[model samples]
Structures are given as structure tokens and as C-alpha cells.
Target chain A: MKLTKLLATGAVALGLATGAWAQDKTKVGFVYVGPVGDGGWTYEHDKGRQAVEKEFGDKVETVFVESVPEGPDAERVMTQMALDGADLIFTTSFGYMDPTINVAKKFPDVKFEHATGYKTAPNVSVYSARFYEGRAVQGHIAGKMTESNIVGYIGSYPIPEVVRGINSAFIHARKANPDVQFKIVWAYTWFDPAKEADAAKVLIEQGADVILQHTDSTAPQAAAQDAGNVITFGQASDMSEYKPKPRVSSIIDNWAPYYIARTQAVMDGTWESTSTWDGIREGMVEIGEITDAVPADVKEEAVALMNSIANGEYHPFTGPLKKQDGSDWLAEGETADDGTLAGMNFYVEGLEGEIPQ
Target chain B: MDLSAINPVLLVASLMVAATPILLAGIGELVVEKSGVLNLGVEGMMITGAICGFAVTVETGSPALGFVAAAVGGALLSLLFAVLTQVALANQVASGLALTLFGLGLSALMGQGYVGIKPPSTPKLDIPVLSDLPVVGRILFGHDLVLYLGIALVAAVWATLKYTRAGLILRAVGENHDAAHALGYKVIRIRTLAILFGGACAGLGGAYISLVRVPQWTEGMTAGVGWIALALVVFASWKPWRVLLGAYLFGGVTVVQLNLQAAGVAIPVEYLAMSPYLVTILVLVILSADKSRAPASLGRSFHAAH
Candidate 1:
């Protein structure tokens, strides 16, 4: 009798709490692929989340679940967030592409934003920054700085996104220094510092004077610092802590403007499903300050290249290019279309290893 | 392929550094399992130690003092597990898993402010004349004090477990706790001490990662190494020297795969990335084929009754 009375009272309280929560204020949810404290990729995304809060104040409520694995578990978290009255949700990371779509189908009223992905529904919109643009600048710097003529790239996965970065960087690097050779090591993880460090050390030992990484972490930067003369560029975030020596420059991912815009869209009832690929011009992909370690000429060249890419004067994937097998890929004076670049799987000419299927 | 890029001496030296943490954790678990306690909270104890070590080192500017605090922190976290399993007689597996989740959360909470802050660098031990000997010197002599300590602990553990009377008692308690209890042994007390030692060792391994390896405090920075150390203990089949061998083998595979990639070997990157885990499991299966030698009363609880 006592248990029944208590249960009835608890149910009433829970109902009233959720009822009050649903009455007003838009709730935005974020799902991160790593811990916010990673000081790299997830950290930047969390900064964007905070930016939304700062923009909207009490008019909006933001909640986030960090370190969410990219699989069925992500779907469950999204589903729960949607059910809990989230008006808009952002699923960050490429691996969350499918899960975001799957949950968006179930919660059609709830708006969905998936990062670095290409799937969409009536409710799900896909967005990504052209990180390869930043890679082109990094390539130029790496090419000019390499005394050993060998540049190492640490890849997180063999996905199209990563392959594109490698190809873009390699092309620009080889252009700057014709004698430059590329050594690629795939760590197969987004954020394992030890493995990333080991990859950096191996590349350094192999006479690579410059290291490029698509993985998230400052381990490679630290490893380059330890290796004394090796140069590196920060990936996904401006890892400025190791500046003036190992980290000469970096690629910064700026997601605040887009995140704030999307939240405002949801608030104004103007949200719609769309695919947005913003880069330097859109201020989505930013180049961090090139430190004193980089020669003034190289820094100028990198900045000029970045400006040209930003102002539509040049494309990173311009033609007179060949596939890895030496087959003609892009004819002279031709440029890669968005379709090809989006689904890019094969490496450009001169890259040795096959992109693991 | 650019095979000339591979340097044999540097490769061997790095493999030792890579193997030290797991080796330390494995040796600690070896002792705990020997005393009939299967505490699966190695991951939790390790992360707790990582944060504690990192925070203390940042505060004191002494890596050695940080390691001491890390060991103590790890042991304290393990004490919760000890009380639950040894005193309260809760199920070991569930309790251990809970401890891991708790430790991970606690470490994340503690490490909030310490993120991106660099800890004091651990200095490598320079042995006067020996460290200068061309190739062999760097491989053997030029390492931080912890690397040598990890190997020394393995040796001491082997010697103690093989020859000491205390080893016999611990083995007796593990193999048949009821019989050992009848023969006037404190099974719970012995197991508690073993658990604490395991926690401390795992803590030291975690510290090695945060202070020396990655040398930073990021959440989940230990990143499943505790579980690898757990598998390594079993892969070694409860032997100390074999644990060292297994650790170096795993580390060697890891380093070699990266080198192979750097050297531009023709293998697929995916295969090379998975090689360390595949090799470790394969060797474990091959070595354990003859006989399965695990402690008989491994996960059983004990209580003294009137």
C-alpha cells in the first residue's frame, strides 16, 4: 500500500518536471566522438557548443554526451536525446553518419546536423569543412622545411576524407620541392596518443624532417619537439603550446559560426535539410599563425596559397594530374568536381601504398 | 621499399619503452592472480594513478614524487575493490567493472584543469662510460630509471614466486583457499595485500604512460592499455619472465609494424595496424595449447566462520 502511494507521487513529479521542461526554450544536443578534454578535435567542437550557449543564453539549453563511440550506441544516445525533447541535435564525427540518419528517420520533427559526413534526410543535414585546403598550406610549409626530403604523414583511417588530405598535401608538397618523398603511416584511430607518438617517432627515425598528421592529439607535436629538428603542423586545432620549434603552423577547424547559425535557424523555424561544405572563404577552415620557425618566404607562400584558395583564385585539386597507377585522372586545365572529391578513394600519382579497402 | 630507413638499435630501445607499462601491470596482476584474487579493475586503478601522478608532478615538479603519489592513489582506489570483494564478499567481476567505470569518471573530473598542462620531464639515466658505447649503449644503458625498474620488478617477482616460502603460502591460498584456510592461513588478508600490490603496480604503469610516454593528462589517455596488461598476464600463463617476454613481443610487433609502414613495405595498412593484437593472441594460443594453468580458486570469495 505504501509502495503504491509512493510510486503514484513519483510518477506525478516526473511528469510535471518533463512537462515544464518541454513548455519553452529550444534544447540543442551534441554528441562528441571523443572526450572534450582531448585538447584537439572534440575540444574544438565543444568550443562551438559553448559558443551556441553564449549566443542564445536562457532562450536555449544545450546538453552534450562526450566520448560517444561511433556505432549502434551513438544511435541510442541520439534517440534518447530526441525523445527527451531536443529541438535540434548535432552528431559530430564521420562515423556517426549512418547512426544520425537512422535516428533522424525516427524523430522527423527533430532537426539533425551531422559533421564530416554525406548522408541526409528531410530532417538530417550533412556538413563538413574542407580540411584539405588547410592541408595544402601545410604541404607547402612541409615541403620547404624538409631538409631530409622525406615528409611523413600519420593517417587516422583510410577513408576518403583522409585520403583526400594526403593527396592534396602531397601534391602541394611535391610542387614546392620536386625531390620530396612521402612516407605514410596509418595509426587507424582518431585519438590514441601513444600510437600516434610511436608513428611520429618511426617517421622521424626514417629521416622525415617534417611530419603531417590527420589524427587528433598533440602527441605527434611532442614527438617532433623531442626529435629536435623535425617540423610538424597542428591538426584540427591550433596546438600552439609547442610553437616556435616543432609546431611551425597549424590547421584550425572553426565551427562556431556554423553552429550558431544552425541553432538560430532552428529557433526561427527556418531550419531545412542541406549539405554545406564550407572552407577558407566561409571561415570554417582556418590556418593558425605560422611561427618564427618557418622561414618568412615559406610563410608568405603558404599564406598566399591560403588566400588564393579562399578567394576562388585556385583549387587544391587542379588538373594535369594522374591516379596512383599513372592513369590519366584529370586532363590538363580540368578541375575535380565536388562529386569526385566527395567520394575520393584512390590516391593521386606517386603515392605508393594502396588505400586499404 | 625504403628498408634503409630502419635502424635496428633504436627499434629495440623503443620496444622496451613501449613494453614497460604493460609489463609492470602484468607482473602486478601475476602476483594478485597467484594469491587467488582476480581483480579486473586494473584499468580503473591505472587511470586513477595517471591523473594522480600527472597532478602531483605538475604541483611538485618532481616526477619521482609524482610516481610515489600515483602508486598510493592506485592502491587507495583498489582498496575500495578490496573491501567490496574481500570483506563484503561481492562478486569480483561486477565489482571490478564498476571500479573501472568509477576510476575513469573520477580521473576525468580530477584531470579537467590539468589538460594541456605539461608535466615535468623524466630524465634518462646516464651510466658513465657504458652509455657512450656506440650502438649497444643506447639500446641497453640509455633509458629512464622506470624502464630498468620495470625489468627489475619482473626479475624480483620471478625470484620471489619461484623460491620464496611466502610464494608457497600464496600459491597454497590460490590453489585451494578452503584447504589453505583449514591449514591456518588468512586467505582474505593475503588476497587483500595482493590486490593492493596489483593496484600499485597498475598505478605505476598508468603513471609511466602519463608522465613518460604521452606525458600528458587527457581523459581516457590510458586508452585500453589496462585491458592489454590484463590479457598479457594470461598470455604469460602466470609466469613473470614470460610476462616480460610477452610485453616485449607485443611492443616489438607494434614498433615493427610502424617501421614497416615508414619503410613503405607492401603490406596493407589495416593488416599492419592489427598485427600487434593478432600476434599477441596467436602466441598466447600456441603457448597455452599444452595445458591450461590458472589458479583453481581464482574468483572465489572466502569467509571465516565459527
Candidate 2:
């Protein structure tokens, strides 16, 4: 009877230990450039993380740290997260690319995904939306709606991302209306509402009735709303509350689907490093609800354009184009490939200002 | 020269506005250091000001009132350090460093809501005739009220130190607090007041960053401007006028590099970007070459009982 009791106790202990070991949660971490509650970049990213929680339930766990500047501090935080047993990490900023790559090298088992960056390692993947596609649609709308024919562009930096957006917008705008002109202001930062608003004011004073921004803030929309009769697009997220006053249409960054898919892959053990520059076709970049403020005919045209792009039946960057220097850019029936678009440094022919060195 | 691309006049104006926060912080620090008080917590004081100014502005909807609140908030934070160093007779350097760390964490917590929201427009002053002049007109005359205030502060501080009896008493206390105490000048009180004033000025500078310069409360928006201000006090050798020159010079370097980039100058962005910091360090090395001019009792702790 004593031997039987000892054997039964031993079996119970072994079963409990195995069960506890199997219950280990897979930890996922995120780093953001802005606070999670900002209702913008970091907010959208956090929403995606929450979506993962909803989808996975108890299969995984999520954690985040906000307002981390892109520098040596980024590396430290990333390493800390990895040390804390994060199975996967997402760094959301272009400046975080190298740091993410560096950390990925140290912990080869950890999966890293860097946003808006090109560099990739064996354990790292790069992901960014086709933001310029949305710019093209915004450009078309601005080109049609503006009575002033002067469009103001609030650019964060002269980096290729912003510059490409400017060119893409200009290309489509000038295509629609030859007389349309753009006044550009370089705020040289991703987020600064004061500078962004000031730049918008300068452009408005200079007679721009339609404004677009590459910066990450609603200041441009606020400034446009305050000015009255001015129109601006929602950047990074749908800002419908300010509709008609400022936001008419927005380029919504839908990360939930991607987040869910990625997390599911991690659960299924099918996760592989890949660079994804998804757009309307992949449903990563979405054009938000077009408001009634836009003319019915223009709205119809915009929707059709969006549908066609989403169906891959039309490309915003279709060419018969030339560079600002009058060099042949694309031949007839040619569209700009991703390779050419990735390193776009020159402006389109109609753009008046020179690219900043 | 692409005049339209790189408008020299507008460039100068922007530089003055951009430099305002640093200028305000730097000048205030210079005064504090001149009084023989070493408050390296300008960054902390500035961030405290930023959060306070932003919060008040959001609550009251009046930026002007917010700025006043910011100054008070900054001075109050400084009082914490003053007590530690003055009453407790702690090490000023360590206490100042602690203040900075505390300020940064506190501001981050306080600035949670004001992150993406835009503040009210900062009023700009347009001098009638001067603003209309070619070249120099736009550079000097057309700016916000703070630019002129910054300039006036340098002159006011210089005159006070050079010509006023109050300045002499303050200087005497700074030079030898032991002697000043023996002479019945109330050394601790004067130093405390000077420290408070410095804290207020630094706070205003910080508020300028959130309220005017960046026009948004960002985490670490001051971006080492406070440290640069601390360095400037040394670079200026505790002189008010030189502080002005240093602020403008550093401001000019920043403006010029930006202008060069806008003008499509062939230099790499990273090199031009790093120039301001590099030059500031070089200037400090040159200025401190004659170490005889430095404050006699800088970073010294005072104990009345001892």
C-alpha cells in the first residue's frame, strides 16, 4: 500500500510539470515612435497588437513600449525585450532599421519586423505600405477640387519616401490639370504639429487651397479646418470627424489583417522572413470613405479609380513620362517597376522646384 | 544662388525662432552659473515646463496663461534641488543630475495627452518699416516677441551684472559665499532666488519648445538643448552678451546648414547635420582656453554650520 501511494504521487508530479511547461506563452513585443494613445501611428500599431490578442486568445501574449526615439536607446530597448524572452519584435520606424538588424544578428532565434525600412537580415523582415498609391488618389482629388490651382505639400523630410509621395501626387495632379502647381514646405521631421501647422499656414497664405502632408500629425487637418474652404487628406489613419472641414478622404493604414496573419503564422510555425510592400491589392493600403463634400461625379471617379487600382487593372504610376531633366523615364505601355520606384530621387517633369541636395 | 529655393531672409527668421528655446534656456543657465550656482538640470526644468505649459494651455485654452504656469512649474521643480543642495548640504552635481532624470520621467508621464494635438498659434511680430527692408529687414525685424525678448534679456542681464549694485552683491556672493555670509548678505537666500530665477527661465525655454518651436509636446523634444545651454554658459564664460552671440552663432550654424541643404549644396546631410555640435564643442574648447575667466566658486557646496 505504501509503494502504490508513492508511485501515484510521482506520476501526478511529472504530469503537472509537463502541463506547466506546455502552458508557456509566446511573447511578442512592439516599439513605437509616438505614444500609443496619440490616435495615429503608434495608436494604429497598438490596435494591430490588440487585434492579435483577439485572434489568438490565450495562444500568445503582447507587450509594447511607446515614445522610443530612434537611436542607441532603440538598440538598448530591443535587446532588453529580447532578453525578456520576446519571441518576436516589431520596430515601427525607418530609423529603427539598422538597430533592429543589429539586434536580430545578436539573437538569431528572434523574429524581427522593421517598418518603412529596406535593410533585412536572415531573422528580419521589412514591411511598408504603398503610400504613394494613396498619394496618387489624393492628388487626383486635390487636382479636381481646387479652384486656386495651388496645392501645398507639407513634407517631413526630403527622403525618398516623402519625395516619392510628392512626385507621385504631382504626376497625377499635373496629369489631371496642367495649370495645377505645388508649393512645398520641408518641415524635416516626422511629427511636429507646430512646424507642420506653420508650414500649412505659409502655404495657405501663398494661395494653396488644397494641402497634403507627409508628416505624422493631424495639425495639417486642423489648420485646414480652421482656414475654411481648404481640403486635406487623412494621413496614416481615417480622420472622419473632421470631414468636409479638412479631411475628405484618407489613406488608412490597415494593419489588423497583417498582424493577425503574421501572428497566426507564428502559431502554425510557418513564419518566414519576407519583405512586403503591399498596397491596395493586398488590402494593406486602403482609401477611407469618400465624403459627400466631394462632388458626386468626382467621388464616383475617385471610387472607380480606387477599385481599378485594387483590382490591379490600373497602375497610378503608368508611364509615358519624363524626368524633371527631360530624360525619358518610361516608354509607352510601361509602368515603373518596384526596383525603379525604390530608388526614386528625381522629380517628374512638371514639378517646378529642384530636389534638395 | 537659388534665391527662391533658399530665401536667406526667411532662413534667418526661422533660425531665430528655432534658437529661441535654446537661447532662453542658455541665457537663464548663464545667469545661474554666474551667480556661482551649477544647475545642470536645465533639461529637467525645461521638460517640466513643457508638460506644465502644455497641460495649462490645454485646460485654459490660453497659451499666454499656460506660459506663466510653465515658469512657476519649472521654478518649483528647481526648489526641490535647492533644498537638497542648500538645506541638506548635498552634492550639487549629483543632485542636478538626479533632477534631470526625474524631470524626464515626469514629463513623459505628464505629456501623455498633448502628444499629437496641435497648440494655438504663436503670435508673430512684424516691425513695420524694418520688415519691409531688403535682406536685413526680414532677418532682424520680422520675428515673434520671444526673439526680441531673448535679445533684450542678454542686454538686461549684462547691464545688471556690470552696472547695478544688486549685480555686485550677487557676484560677491557667488565669488565667496563664506565671505558674503560673514558680511551679512544672506548668501543662501540670494543663491536660492538666483536658482529659482534660472529655473523659471529654463522653464520658459522649455515651454517655448512645446508651445512655439516644435509647437508640439514630443518626448525628449528639447533634444539636449539643455545640455547645450549648460555648455554655452561655459562657452560664454558666464558673460551675458557672449551668451547672445553664442546662441545666434549656433543658431546661424543650424540655419546655414539647413539653407545649404535647401540650396542643393553637394555636402552630405549627415556632415552638415553634425557641424553645429562639432563647432559648439570647438568653440567651448577655445573659450575655456583661458580658464582664468571661469567662475571662482562654480559647482561648490556651501554649509553655514561648517
Candidate 3:
């Protein structure tokens, strides 16, 4: 009788232990296009995920899978994570659009967040930053600093996001200095350092004193450092580590506030499907401190422009622009609307080349 | 098209750099096949070279030393295939495929630390007056040393095969191993040396990619370059100069497509991106259709005991 009673207690204790542990934490999952320590795009997103953990302490549990290619593989990973009880999942990449939608359709209970994608289901939401706003600032700096009147742009692909950045930078730079021209080199990839560096070298040889890139690597900055006196900006993260040399300023994507707010919404039971596109005005996009590379007057002008943009007192893209083919694009004092910016597939007049069809 | 926008110099220079990895791997495979060894582990060995090259470059801050490490890594991995096929007398085709699979997985693990770090820059050899000439300067005189070495290797291999007595013996062994064995040439030893040389070249190619082409380490960075290199050996009809021609031709397609996009040609980005691979396939199909050009002992295995 005593042995039977002891056995029943041990079984009961084991069941309670599992139940308690499962109930103690809320599970969150993240899938990335690159390794978490890339010190660039995925690195910044991982930082935000870490912020969520710190804020909630023991209340939340998180898991991540890195270097997950976007396609059927992504669908499998998402489905598996949901089946394993991921309350919320973030699939980060433009290519993850269909996968996120497909997974959300199957798992209605799981919340899905996709970066730079447009597909949406009842349980899914898409989000992207106003990266063009940062480009506007870089354009202003490039316009003033360029003695050769030439700027180089390393483009990854002719996607809307990359096209939008090129146009925005051109719009603002031409506004500051009418003589400024853009020399573009398409590397045809999101991250290929050799190609990107070679493109930069070609541009530098072509007399471009300032360089910009839409690809996700610091190759441009490294190339700029080697070229001496050339200027470059950081993409996706604050790469101030290479500061006081090639990196004059950086466009820092602040995803922490959004991540914290979204997780809290999940906890408070008020989570709803919505698209959030925030910029410097909403503290979602941040500009790193200008280094000693810039002249004091230029720095002051840039800060003034930043304040105006934040306060809604000025617009960088307020227009008087022409297409590369010398066609009228925007009327005087008229800014491009969201629709035009979203589908921007043409190069403006100041850019010497065309955006291929 | 704007010839002015082409920058003939940079185009030629880029082509040379791009061709080196392919050339090294292809020429190595050519030697292996000439000696009646079929090794598909070229891809695996190339990847091993990539990771090993990147890791050493990161540690030592020297791209040259990294290339050396890459060769060593590639050779070591190739030995796995050698022992399996030579000692165990395993099927050569299956052993080669296994080597590729193992190489890919091992490189991914080894490359964890090198995921995003920028590798050390390769040094440029500016050929004084030649580099200053308008069109020729950028193309011929402005390439890194690897480009020149790759060209010289092609010539050296060509001369050895065409003129040297050792070349005659290697050819004799590959053509009729049993007859060569009776005449006192160690067929196994010769074939093994050729296999190791192929591995070293593959490693050099892999290193050239990590140290020059992409200049960073990522999972699957070679991205079928090894396979393309293998295909080129067949496309070249086992000739050294033809291998160079095939490599540059493929490299030209790659460079041209990118140029088209940059110059704002009216092609969809996806199609433009896939064009090079498509053309490569078409070229292979056309070349392979002419079976008369293929080697007699292309995939034959020789066993002394048998």
C-alpha cells in the first residue's frame, strides 16, 4: 500500500513540473535571411528581439533560426515553428512574402510579421521603414561635399525599395546642388562584397567623390577608406565603428520600439493586423552623429534639415524634377505620393542611367 | 550599347579575376580525367578552400597565405575520395558525389565565424605604362597577380602536354593502364599525383573566390561555380586553351548581363539574372551533342589488382 502511494506521487509530480514550465513562458520565434551576428541587417533585428526578452524578463521565451532561405524551405520552417507552439513569428525578408501568407493561412492562431513584404492574412501584418527619408539626408550631405559634382550608387537590384532610395537621394542632392550627378553600378545581389567593392572602385575611378549603396555590406565603406577623402554612409545599422574615416553618418533602423510595442500588444490581448511604416518623424529611423569628416557649417545645415523633416516643416522630395529621358516627373513644390514612391521604377534626370525594365 | 560605358579595361580585368577560380578548378579536373580518374568532389574541395582561405585570411591578414591554406584544405578533403576509390575500389562517380556533400556541410560549420566579416583586400599589380593606356590599361595591365598566374598555368600545362616526355608517359598510362604497367610505369602513383594536383588547383580556385571574387564567406558562396568548372572541362574538349576560352566566355556573359542592367536595358531583373546560367546550359548541350570530341577514357576506372 505504501509503495503504490509513492508511485502515484512521483507520476503526479512529473506531470505538474511539465505543466508549470509550459505555462510559465510565452514563446516567440524569429527566422532570418542571414546569421544573427552579421553586424548589419539581421544583427539589428536580433538586437530588437533581445530587447523584447530583457523587457519581459522571465515572462517570454524566444527561439531563432538563421540563414533560412526564402521559399518552400521558409514555409516548412514557419509551419514547424507554429506546430511547436510559437505564439508569434517574425519572417524577415522581402522574399518571405508568399511563405508568410501561406503559413498564416494554415495556422490562424499564430501571429505573423514579415519585413518589407506586402502579403497579408487575418493573422499576418507587413512592415517596412521609410528608408527613403534617410536617403534624403545622405543626398543633402553628398550634394554639398561633392567637389567633382559626381556621386556613386551601388544598387543591389532594381526593386522598388532600391529605386526609391536612388530617386530620393537624387531629389535632395539636386535640390542642394544643381550640378550634382549620379553614377550607378548595379551589383545584382543583396550582399556580394567583391562585386560591391569593384563597383565602388569603378565609380571612384570615374570621379565620384561620394558613394552610396543599397546592398547589405560594409564593402563600400572599406572601399571608401582605401580611396581616401571619399565619403560613404552606413546601411541597416549604425556602423560607427568605421567612423572618423569613410563613414560620415549612418541611417540606423530603430526596430526596438516597434518590437517592444508589438510584443506588449500580444500580451495585452489587443493585437490587431496593421502595417506600420515609420521614419525619423516617429523615432523609427535615426541618423547617427555626424563625424569630423563634415565641415561644421555642413553639419549644422544637415541637423537643421533633420529637425525640419522631423517637425514636418520641410520635405526633401518637394519637386521640380525630370525623368532620365527629360520628361516631367513632378511639378514644382509637389512631393511624390505614396503610390508613386512605392512603384518608382524610373531614374530621375540627375541620374545618368536608366532603370532597366 | 555604349563602348564608353563598357570600360574595356575594368571589364577585361574583372573577367580575368573571375576566370581564375574556374580555370584552376577546371584545369585540375582535366588532369584528373586525363589520367582516368573521375572525381565530382571538385565542388566540395572548392568550398573547403573557400572557408579555409577566408579563415586564414582573417587570422593572418594575408590573402596569399590564405590561398596556400585553401590548397591544403582542398587536397586533404580530396584524399577522402582518393582512399575510398583507390583502396576500397568504390565506384568513382558515387565517391565524388559523396565528397561534394561532405565538403558542403563541413564548410558551413567552419564558416560560422566568418559569416559577415570583410576579408582582407587582394593587392593589385599596376603594370606601369600598360595600365595607363586607354582601353588596354584596365583590361590587361590592371589585374591582380592571380589573373596572370592563371593564364601562365594554362600555357604551362599546354606546353607540358604538347612537348614534355612526362606528358607522353601520363597520356600512355591514361590511354592503356595495363600496357603502361607492363612497361614499368606506376599507373596508380601517377593517377594519385594528378588527383592531388587537381585538388590543389580546386583549392586555389576556391581561395580565389573568397579572397577575390565575393571577398566574404557565406554558406554556399561558390554557388555551383565548381559544377560550372566541371562542365567547362568537357566544353573545352580537354584542351587547356579551350578551357580558358570557355571560362572567359561564361565570365563575359556574367559581366555583360550585369552591364545590361546597369545601362538600363529593358529586361526583367529575374530573367536577366537567370540568363547566364541558361546560356551556360545551352552551351553545354550543344557541346555534348558532339560526342566525337570527348575523351576515350573519360570516366573509366583502372584497378591494378584486377
Per-candidate DockQ values are 0.68, 0.12, 0.17
Better of 1 and 2 by TM-score: 1
Residue-wise C-alpha lDDT for candidate 3, range A6-103, written one tens digit per residue:
99999778756644664557778898876564556777788989999999988887778876776899999999778767778888877788999988
C-alpha lDDT of all candidate models, in order: 0.90, 0.79, 0.80
Q: What is the TM-score of chain A alone in each candidate?
A: 0.95, 0.91, 0.90
Q: Which residue pairs of candidate 3 clash? A: B9-B138, B9-B139
**lDDT tens digits by residue: candidate 2, B238-273:** 878677767777767776665554444666656766
| Model 1 agreement with the true structure over A205-286: per-residue lDDT tens digits | 9899999999888888878887789999988899888787788988899999999999999999999999999999999999
**What is candidate 3's TM-score against the reference?**
0.82
> Candidate 3 at B264: error in angstroms?
5.0
For all the models shown, what interface RMSD does each have? 1.2, 5.3, 4.2
Segments in model 1 whose C-alpha atoms lie over 4 Å from true places: A1-23
Candidate 3 residue A28 C-alpha distance from true site, Å: 3.3
Kindly give the stretch of ten consecutive residues in candidate 1 chain B with the minimal lDDT sum.
B283-292
- Clash list (residue pairs), candidate 2: none
Q: What is the Å distance of residue A109 in model 1 from its true position? A: 2.1
